[model samples]
Target: MGVRMRLTTVETVHEEGSWLFTVRDQYGADEEVVLVPCEDGVEAWINRCTHESQRLDTGRGAAMRDGQIICPKHGSMFDSCTGYCDNGEAAETTLPSVDVTVEDGTVYLTDDEVSYLRDGGIDEDEDEDGGPSSTSHLSF
Candidate 1:
């Protein structure tokens, strides 16, 4: 068990399809995590797709269908509950897990490798100027 930091309410995650948050890893690098509703509770995964660096949820929310997280890049589907991809480009890969727990309707960040920073992706103001945006490679 690690430091339990409050994230957001479980109901909020369900309403948003997914919740995005930022955390700082032990190495001092910032990472994004997404929370999606599951059968038992909410599951958190590193925001990027397993096949590439594309973010699964680009701030607004992740595209979810039939309980799976849909990759916006190549349409790969990952199980929201398990983060496992059985088909498409991401097959055989699992989204990096970020340990989280839900208790009394509120979510908490419990991963020892990361410390909660803030909600949503890294702020643009905090990013290096002139650096490419995360979605710059997308055709749309």
Candidate 2:
């Protein structure tokens, strides 16, 4: 099992419909994950689409319909609970799912690397030390 990290409270998660959270994997790489409220509890998956690696939400809340997550770019539908894409160009593919749970009113992302700044955007500006420092403000 990977590290477990508290993301947000259940109430907050439902209030926002869905929450996008990022984590740093063991290799020090960032991964974007989104948490969606479901009937059983909460479902979490990577924010990218399976077809062309586009963002599923593009900074907006995930578009859901008939218990499926809709890809804005390709109009593909993925089962929210299972991440399986049974239609559209992404057939035979699945959105990467991250394990999560709502415990004591708090949502926790588990069995994965937890880093909050993975999706903070890249910094093309170099610092005084000749290394990239964030030139733009971080967004989502």
Worst 10-residue stretch by lDDT in candidate 2?
Answer: 131-140
Clash number by candidate, in order = 0, 2
Q: Which runs in model 2 stand beyond 4 Å of their true positions? A: 1-3, 113-140
Could you give candidate 2's per-residue lDDT for residues 22-91 as a string of tens digits? Answer: 6666688777787776775778888777877766654557777767777766677788878899888788
Q: Candidate 1, clashing residue pairs?
A: none
> Which 10-residue window of candidate 1 scores lowest in summed lDDT?
130-139
lDDT of 1 by residue, 78-112 (tens): 99999999988889999999998889999999999
Give the lDDT of residue 49 in candidate 1. 87
Report lDDT per candidate.
0.85, 0.69
Candidate 1 at 98: error in angstroms? 0.7
